[model samples]
Target chain A: MYKGYVVDKALLDKDPHFKAGCILCHAGNDGELSKEKAHLRMLKKPSDNLRSCGVCHKKTAANYAKSLHYTTIGQRTGVMPRFSEAELKTFDEKVFEKSCRSCHASCGDCHVKGAPVGGISIGLVAKHKFVKKDEGKTCAFCHGGRVYPEYTGDYGGAPDVHYQKGMLCMDCHKKAEFHGDGTAYKSKNEVPQRPACKSCHPQGKEAKKETQVAHSLHDGKVSCYGCHSGSAYRNCNDCHGGHAAAGPGMILGRSPRDRKVLTTLRLIPTVRDTFAPAGIKMEHFDAVPNYWDTPAHNIKKRTERTRKCDVCHVDRKNFLTKETLIKNGAKANEELIFVPKAIAR
Target chain B: MKNRRTFLLAFLAVWILALYGAAVFAATPNKCIQCHTNDALMKSLHKPPVLPKSEGEG
Candidate 1:
């Protein structure tokens, strides 16, 4: 390793980037042989600035600038629908920048260095060599806490069939979604390239006729994860104050975006004093549950609810209600409590 | 005494040469503009997004 950066022989000998030399990307004095002087203004991650990557990949950089990964607009918009106009302005200017923005992925954060999340920065993603993508170290490094673990069955549930079949995030989520198609969408829902369960599993393609009929009953109303997600998933609470005060749990509720849809509800770490640093306190702290319409990654082809029709249809106890919520702050999440309606089928 | 003086001068010359050799023989120019000034390279270097500009002191 040269000064903590592993010198990849292949990259040094073959890659154009290495041929261009280190000083081209990492700025500093090449004339000085002293380590300190050579690294005076060296950029550990040059790709953090679009200019570094844009020189060769202009179109991708242009589209990526507007992508959700860059702007984190989807996360910003998710909370917008819950707050008032006055609160939103303060949130945009203060709370978001202080608390949420750091977690948002930058281009270099993925393709070059490890993401800086919760103030923890891992080593370089690929030892200063620019990579197109490395899902394990790059994507999982940030998403490791919840999504990655659940996808791999590390969270005590059966792994997603897709993951078992060796499908990476890039497999389902195409390049357009990552680099963006030049549309500034407010949420992932608004993106035209957003992945849907229906996209891969179309009607009557592989599913049985009975399964199609059952899906149709709740078409456009419920997400497939509502019933198909078999195991308990992450629903964090009280993040601003204490880190240990949170753990994963399952909760069901009406989708915040679509009221009629009963979907899997995960409590985002937005609490009363969530933005106390910015001097903004959420007024309706307990008025509504901070349940966002979450796409729970833990999915099973056959689940408790899908094992048989009557398990969900007749079992009122299993449904989300005051009795079923096990966590401490769950009672406050009144809005997301699933209610049973008469099934016409 | 003459031999000692010759040894000292030789050591000094070697030290200076070792320090300056790598920089002088570097394949790429030490100047930033030498490579960055290339139109093809510069054109590809696109401008970054206008992120929320704040004091970041918050």
Candidate 2:
């Protein structure tokens, strides 16, 4: 009922929660009393570390320790970065945490996630399952330019498909590719993801026959992603082999060794059960709760229910067996067995 | 007959030189150290390999 300033003491006093505090995060005396110490003290509050975060988060802390946020605020101004290294002075550590992570978390506040074992009760609603949502918003919120510099026009700027569409960082950068240990480069290099052409069409083979690469040879060695994952493609030397094209590129991909399945498709199922933390060895995002197969696709079916060999190897007349493909020049031992033949120097 | 004899001798000489050159390039570290006392190339090898850039580049 109080419409103007300085007239709400009696009205808001009816509520116990509202009447007990001056601010949500800050509490102290009036401003006319104790210098600027209240504001300065509010700025220096330490972030609440979860009871279990450090038991597993030391290495990241080390990397972030050397970062600028730790150097400046964690040491100098005494504030911890709330978000991640993608927001602020991302060129360095300190600014990135202070500007990006801290801005989202401290100001944005608490998050909730699904419990590994417990059911969702009414008691858990305060913590919305929004850590990734908050992180994605932190990236595109203000300074999304570090990744997308052409943000001036309407056609581009963090992709129009992502803006307020409930889309996230993983949705585009790597929707289908598994995010194991959150890095694609360092994991056991087995079963390289056959990047799905899903977004380019509908999921699977109702997909229009989009022409990508016309390989002269339908050999097992060539793959769609072996050539195109970046803005520009380096020579074969940079990826499959060392920076010297003198040798065959390292076939880091591991298919089942003892089997004789030819070039159509393969799956190396992760040993862990789906309920466990280690369930996904490949880090696939759309993880079926109990499924363990990492489906390496050479094709997607017409109905798309079964993603198999025909998506690429449609020339049914020339389906070569494993031995036949080897005779046609797929390397004899391509599991990276040799030390790259000493680089042929 | 004379031309055939010359061709055989020429082939023999080429084979001998090529085989010997392979053995020399595969020389052990001790033998290489005898000539390369400064050890500059050996030291450089331990670093992550960089391609020998053409001139006027980093």
What lDDT tens digits, residue by residue, belong to model 1 across residues A21-84? 6778887886765556777998867877777788998998888888888888877776665566
In the predicted model 1, the residue pairs found to clash are A54-B44, A55-B44, A55-B45, A253-A336
Point to the candidate with the largest lDDT: 1
Window of ten residues with lowest summed lDDT in model 2 chain B: B28-37
Candidate 1, residue B24: how far the Cα is off, in Å: 6.5
For model 2, residues B1-58, the per-residue Cα lDDT tens digits are 9999999999999999999997974542222112122234324433332444321100
Assess candidate 1 and give its lDDT.
0.69
DockQ for each model: 0.04, 0.00
Winning candidate number (TM-score): 1
TM-score of 1: 0.79
The global C-alpha lDDT for each of the candidates, from Candidate 1 onward, is: 0.69, 0.28
Off by over 4 Å in 2: A1-35, A43-137, A141-146, A150-206, A209-345, B1-58
Off by over 4 Å in 1: A1-4, A81-86, A284-288, A323-333, A342-345, B1-58
Worst 10-residue lDDT window, candidate 2 chain A = A232-241
What are the per-residue Cα lDDT tens digits for candidate 2 across A98-177? 32233222212222221111111121112212243343333333323223221212222222223345544455444123
* DockQ metric, candidate 2: 0.00
